[model samples]
Target: MWDDWARTAQPLKGKVAIVTGAGRGCGRAIAQGLAAAGASVCCAARSKSEIAETVALIEEEGGVAMAFAADVTDLQSVTAMTHATIAAYSGLDLMVLSHGVALAVGPVETTDPVDWQRTIDVNLIGSYYCIRTAVAPMKARGAGKIIVVGSGQGHNGTASTSAYAASKAGTWALTRSVAAELIGYNISVNELLPGNVRTQLYEDTFGQVISATPAGGEPISSKRSHEWLKAPEDIVPLALFMACQPDIGPTAQSFSLMRRV
Candidate 1:
């Protein structure tokens, strides 16, 4: 029974994937989902304990995974993650850049330049670090999948989020440029823009916005409010589709779950 079950569930069987910022939320979900589909996932995150928990969950479910301590902003850390993955799993096939940071909201004038810099460093630069290094083995092998978790703000601008918006937009552009470079290599690079899911980041950032508003009328429109935000799991199917189906999937393109109802 165990052997049969394992064989049936192994689509990504021996493939190795590195999911950054996988300590929690979207990254964690993506890591587990890939593992469930038979991928030996390396859950990379800055937090050791958090990533350890993620790996534990995957192992508990009979999936193969490893928790890695890594900071996406540092190419060295990201490169080490890829190196470790190759050492453990023997080959690299997928890279999920799900790491991101959302700073406290405030008007442009009120926003701190340092805070803004940090935002770009995490969302844009950090992603670049992961991609630049991960592409090595992929490019050498001539096949791989790079799934970037983007934000709606990248395409559609939002108020009081200047830094985040710019950072995300830059990340998407980076995705397109890299996709073009991977054209004939069989390496698919695409950006997966997530919807308004009430994860820890969302609650910490936007929750404050709603709280600061004067009592009585709602601050944001109903369409963009908490009531409309879907669970993180709701967006996982599309993420998995974009991830596991690289050959037949679109590359140098961007897809989003922003159309939630």
Candidate 2:
């Protein structure tokens, strides 16, 4: 059954997608997934070098993609990136909010004020700016898809990571609100809460913490017999499913990816 769906699910052909934070990590995976499904992807990120690399990879694989550098936390930069995507693609069918920063793990009482502010600025405020800038074009076209990359921590609580968790929780709410408001215009909005994907960002932060502890002492992976962690590629299929099947009735919801028990 799933094989049949995959063979027939090329619904996004000729569509245009904008993936923020596409320089690396899960963003790169999402961009490539969309491109593989026949969408022209606009890869947006703060680092021009990494974004270019992502674009190059996509093009090498016979996919259509272009790189654009923008600081999503800055409103003007977000606007410029959106406009550039529209000008190039002539239309925008999808917007994926995947840009975020994860500060060092620390208790709420000990976290620096600046770091907390930066978390909110990039994770929450930046997502809002991207969605706001993309809405105008999507509304004009009367159809679109918006997927916000949230975290499992957002649904529950994780010790010593209040800022990241809170930012992601806000993203969940933002997704719900946008879905409620945009459904009238035929735009679908949703949130994807990834459990633990092996991306550069995840490896740099959580990998170090996990490595320092013994197998039995690790938080999430402590009980797992297999030491392997899921990769960004594993999460991209669900993202592509959501993006291409926007007409599905699962808007305003959050889905998590985790190994089966």
Q: Pick the candidate with the highest TM-score.
A: 1
How accurate locally, in lDDT, is each candidate? 0.82, 0.82
In model 1, state the lDDT of residue 151: 83
Candidate 2 structure quality by residue, lDDT tens digits, 38-66: 88999999899999999999898778999
Backbone collision count in every prediction? 0, 0
Write the residue-wise lDDT of candidate 1 on 1-93 in tens digits. Answer: 322443476667778899998999988887888887788999999999999999999999898999899988888888888899999988889
RMSD for all candidates, in order, please: 3.5, 3.3
Point out the worst 10-residue segment of candidate 1 by lDDT: 1-10
lDDT of 2 at 232: 74
Pairs clashing within candidate 2: none
Error of 1 at 33 (Å): 0.4
